[model samples]
Target chain A: MVSLILSTAVRYIFPLQLLFSIFLLLRGHNEPGGGFVGGLVVAAAFSLVALANNVWTAQRTMGVNPRVLIGVGLLAAAVSGLQALIAGQPFMTAAWIARDIPVLGKVGTPLLFDFGVYLVVIGVTLTIIFTLMEE
Target chain B: MMQVNTVMNIWIVLPILIPLLTAVGAVLAWNWRRVQRVLSVIGSAALLGAGLKLLLTVWTDGILALQIGSWPAPFGITLAADLFSAIMVVLAGLLAVTVTLYSLASMDMERESFGYYPILHILLMGVCGAFLSGDIFNLYVWFEVLLIASFVLLTLGGERAQLEGAIKYVTLNLMASALFLAGVGVLYGIAGTLNMADLAVQLAKMEHPEIVTAVSMLFLIAFGIKAAVFPLFFWLPASYHTPPVAVSAIFSGLLTKVGVYALFRVFTLLFVHNIRYTHTMILIIAGFTMVTGVLGAVAQTEFRRLLSFHIVSQIGYLLMGLGLYHPAAMAAAVFFMVHVVLAKSTLFLVSGVVHWLQGTYDLKKLGGLYASAPGLALLFLIPALSLAGIPPLPGFFAKLALVGAGLQLGQYVISAVALAVSILTLFSMIKIWNEAFWKPQPLAATCASAQPVLLIIPIVLLALVILGIGFFAGPLFTLAARAAEQLSDPAGYIQAVLGGA
Candidate 1:
């Protein structure tokens, strides 16, 4: 049976974990935090739900197929490289919008690439975890 | 003028770009299996066209290098194609198109829906990436990409046999990757550069040449495992026959060759300081690899398993050329690579058909394609005889080149071994012909008269490609000669990549 105290604590912890993961993703371009660590944090939060609740509820909370996430992440990374190819330069040349965007600083392809990495990390890790747990 | 540069540069990387987008296209269209099939085939066709263009560009313009992200040489990742790499890309594209088409008709519905096509394209992308990568670290990354994809493809069906095969395949290959990465790490520490060209320059000038020689063994073992050479080859025959026919066919055609390619690339580019020890060691390994592989083939009763053993044997001939370490020997290796890919894949595809028709690959349970299906027998014989190196076939000419080079260099023992190996190879091939084709009908009336159009098309296409190589031996030899010449002189490659640095 699910422990009431653990379930209640996870409910409060999950939202904060997601917020921290996002913070990691945002800071990834320059600082130590990036998509990989950020994704792991989110995956850990979801796993806690599976421990305190159940896998079905965790899947419901995520509300997206892991395979689809992989596809989208790969698409984002490849397209970021392709945009440079289209712009008559070598592939993956970082191009910036030339303006600082609020808290995210100047936006560019590298940041997009980091976000793609974030998505793939989450997709692959959860795919492994879910498959093993189910087994 | 700038537009012209962009257009030319675009051709150099299209082999990789097309497949990456193709995989992404297949993945994103996950909900629609029909769309995925059409997309995969079309993507493969496009890759074939791009491969041809890339080959043509490399033919006329010479070695082309792209500094990705416009980073300077020895710093940024680079994608480059010389004549040899371009040819391999073309071969990869050709195999991709054939296998993708074959899978459309033969792949199970479960594997189809579970992301098969996407993963297949990703494997192609990794193969092309490995062929085109100019940086050593980038090469390792591409190897992992392809290896990971191969692992997933091998286990797609989740059959007990597939799972068993995949576990061995995964463990051995992961060890190879660890060795490869460790080699990379140590090389970087010594040479302080990840660019292959830059490393060649620095490695050549090192004060203690013996340390570099010691380090070369790491690559030999690492690549030897991938190439399935000598002691490192058991993983291949153990796991290769376990996959679906389409998967086996492509793996037979291209996967081990990637390992061989890395061996050729690394030895010629960076580790030429002491040819006496290193290349000679390869020569010894090549000889044993040939003997063991053919002997294993002689003992196999199953069709696919026999073919897997032969892949290892065929690699021996390629290595014989490398072991000889002359320009003509290298040229011979290049020619043999192209010839064997077509021949081996054709044989595998024919075996797929045999299994499909009779519902078994066991020779004891099989017989009489000769009586019921003369055309299929002919298809099988063309590649079988070619593989056995009969006259006027691609295999004969390829063998002649290697043996001739071996004799020319006075490496008489290896040349003699090469000849003896071919005889054994012929004996094993004949065993298959007798058991599977020439023997009397085992099932009698159950032998169907017709084969599926989809299955026959690829086997016939590849066999005809084998025949084509036999017919146009002169031009193929010329291209291989040019590639070998480029490999013979690392200075041109180093200059082209480093560009006045």
Candidate 2:
């Protein structure tokens, strides 16, 4: 019942949006576009896909349960803080190991925590949206 | 014997962390329901251990203060645990474990699958965070976390009755949150600091005392609503009886107490400069809250609803200690809080079991619990009697301490009301006993025979704690006294958190 052109456009747009989200997430620590924003962006893209196609197709694209995504996201964030506990520092005291990745600059616990935040925002948003859409 | 170091700070943070991790873990393994259940219990146990360590560490090392991200005070968020905060955190941990244990048996599988464990742990994380936070803004953040979780838990079943209750609960609490935030914003604007200890020092030096008093009134209304004091308490009984009993038990145990704790903390630490005015208002509110709440309870015929009303009434006693504003009174408040948290939750948990077995919370329909489940009937008596301020019970000591403080302070009218409220409280509790246990069943319907081990364990454990507190009141009173001394002296708190003394 839907137009082929719109679906085709969404297919291309989804991957591009996802890539942009990753860029925003990686750039977050030093820039304005952080995990929360990036995650929201990705969730918005997925929502568009679901709207264009169907929720089932969107779920297939996600491949993992959104609830599990939330759990993993929380773990990642907690681990970033736990690293400080392990190193005999105060809890959540950011400690970094400089490993230069090509475009992302130095990767560190703060970035890791931001990544976790990104996933959590994505998971929570998609979970709520998907449930409401199904209803 | 206590080493004050960065590593020690981890102990201060673990009660919050452990619950967060557990909630995450439970959610991640949602597909495996058994795994989720096991993980939640283990997580709660770990929190209890963490709480014990934190309490012991604070008891030995003085106030244990730590800055998250190693940022110094006035700039970074500090999680500081003095004797009072430590006591609260430990009590939270204890409540968490017992409540979770009760939920394991009493809660339905459908509810558990609806992310119940994750939400419960998050609620505890909020509570521990609220207790440990040294910044007013951080406290607000924690309050939001707990509030959100509570909203989910309260409305999880999607019953028409629950939905109605949830609406009232959420609306009033949201109003409270808004008021609290407004007060925090004004306080921050005036003092230019969010750290509670720092705010205390700055507030003392501020030239505009009138604005400070206005801000204090804002806080009083906000906390008064949350604490369900007097005219502000209509929402509590309206909503609390609607939740699943485990949910009710925790809410009954910790939620309002958190509000009372905030009132005590802010008034004693930051708003002390205007005590004659602010505390006298608190004293007047406390007196009315007691009379109205007990009278409401006397009029209730339902089980959980009666307990809900009692929670409001007991808040009056807790606030009375704060209103008195002396070390003995404050210590009594702390002791009474601990007693209420344990005893009240036990009553709710018992109500859960009765509901489970008898299939109703209405006292009119229920009868002969003593004949049907003698063990549960017995378990109920301990907390019930203890609640009524029977001698040699923890509640007796708790009430005695508060009344003594009131009498000592020569607040005779309030003291008389406190004594009178205890008698009325006993009368209502006896009403429950006579209707639910002593009276013959109106219908000879068969009650369930088997007692779930998971359910009984928490009930028994809580009862034992109430009894323990009653018999061995020495150590607890001393600890509470130390906490009271710290609360009485805000300079000591400020120096410990800000100066690392």
Candidate 3:
């Protein structure tokens, strides 16, 4: 089973997978990656953890329930869309910024929207995986 | 401070922002049920206030627009609230408040593992955002927001029936999303701008009539699936009856109306010039949709299923008014949509109470509920009769407006069909009354006990709203008429989106 493989590999690879997911989420707005893809990657990582350690352990390790993740994701996505309203623009109007920070420079609403998408992807993906595993 | 001109721009964003903030607040308050309840109530109330405030401002001042991130109009996303969008936001907010109250009493906390209040708030946020978005692509994003929330709500309990229904609901909606995306792609390719107001301007200047017609047809098909218009309506009745009563009530009240709202927006603003072909097709479809939907209702013995089918039947009237395209007719369509939301949601909730008492929504098995639950029966009667278009109720006036508009246009055949459908609607409602309320009690003493007051209060309040709209038809009708006028004349909308002429 996939769980067997995940269990063996999770002890060695979870942190790297988590880092990969964050990278995907952060780079999504400009590149081919974004919230949805990032969320999926994160969910896949969690699934690997679940497969290795058992669903409960995986759930506990994530530190938040999948359903809560979904709620948070929905809230995040909605907030990201509403950012347009703050600027006197319409809903879900993608707004961005180019900044020169010490290391990172740009931030925008699309990235936020992508983050929302990431949460939704992780929430939905885990909801399915966990529910199926429970069954 | 010199009176700045930009204060009004904030009003445009208020619609989406209030609900979004409230959703977050609701989630954060989830650990404290009392705080969650207070947050949800106040949040929705605030949204309602914001919506009304925007409506009044628009009524006095005309249209308002906001440019996100200081970007110029054509390139940046625009959030504009004209008469039409403002009214929808207010209505959506009001319904949301009532549904939240209803859910507070009805939802099972154990089964609702995720934060139920938060999801409901976000769903409202999505609905409001969709109504307020000025661009086509943004509308797609809002639709997905609402659709995903609804999918979760639909299958919340994971009952066998709920899961089955959710599968059909999700799959069908995904297909509709694909169709919507395709339509947007074609439209963007042809017109070169996804902004609705900009598209309207460009589309007006384009010469190829055939291409315009094809694009309009694509929009019709895409929105039709969402609105549950005749050919695309089968998925609605199948899935709608499966969700819990409160979830079903909110879904029935708000979701399809958003679709209807979108169709009206796109057709009136963007595709108005192609009236002959599109209008004629709409008229034909509207007529069939009314008759067939009612026939489906008549065939149903279950309370929820019957109401689900009736939702389809009533949508026909809304579309008919739009198809007529007269200002009065469009106003009637707006009025009809408001009436249906109030009436249908009341009926669905009453059915919930019936199920709580008799353990069934089957009409044959649900006799003498009137004796046991007189308050519920009365709550049921108002919307039921209103839905059947009985005089002095909102539904009656809504139907009257549509019928009058049909007659004014000399669309006699369609008018006649509308009359026939109204009569059949009455018949089906009476059938529900006869089987569910008037017949002798089918159950023992325990089943005859009073229903939960918490649940009944929301239903009664909604019924009151129905009556209030009916009695004070002047102001609301005027509001609807103003929205219709704005819809008919896209000048203000275009100007607002293209950054204030």
* Candidate 1: regions farther than 4 A off: B1-6, B445-448
Point out the worst 10-residue segment of candidate 3 chain A by lDDT: A97-106
lDDT of 1 by residue, B372-396 (tens): 6788889998888888899899899
lDDT of 2 by residue, B1-501 (tens): 113467777888998999999999899888788898899999999999999999999888788888888888889999888889899888998999999899888888999999999999999999999999999999999999999999999999899989999999999999999999999999988999999999998999989888999999999999899889999999999999998999999999999988999998899999988889999999999999999999999999999999999999999999999999999999998999899999999999999899888888899989998888899998999998888899899888888999998988899999999999999999999999999998988887667878899999999999999999999998999999999999998877898789844
Candidate 1 structure, TM-score to reference: 0.98
For each candidate, what is the lDDT? 0.90, 0.91, 0.84
Task: Report model 1's chain A TM-score.
Answer: 0.95
TM-score per model over all chains: 0.98, 0.98, 0.89
Q: What is the interface RMSD of each candidate, in Å?
A: 1.3, 0.9, 4.3
Candidate 3's residue-wise lDDT over B1-501, tens digit each? 102425666676776777777776776566777777788888888888888898888888888776665566778777778888888888887888788787777888753436677788778888988998888999999999999888878887788999888888888788888998999999899989998999999899988968988988888888898899988988899999998898889899989999898999999989988798898899898998999999999999999999999999998999999899999999999899888988998899989988888888888778997787787788889999999999899888888989998898899999999999999999999999999999986655356376677888888888889989999998999989998998888997898678544
Writing each residue's lDDT as its tens digit, candidate 2 over A38-134 gives: 9999999989888888888888899988888888999999999989889888888897766688888768888889989999999999999999988
> On a 0 to 1 TM-score scale, where does candidate 2 land against the true structure?
0.98
Error of 3 at B206 (Å): 1.6
Candidate 2 residue-wise lDDT at B233: 97
Residue B29 miss distance in model 1 (angstroms):
2.0
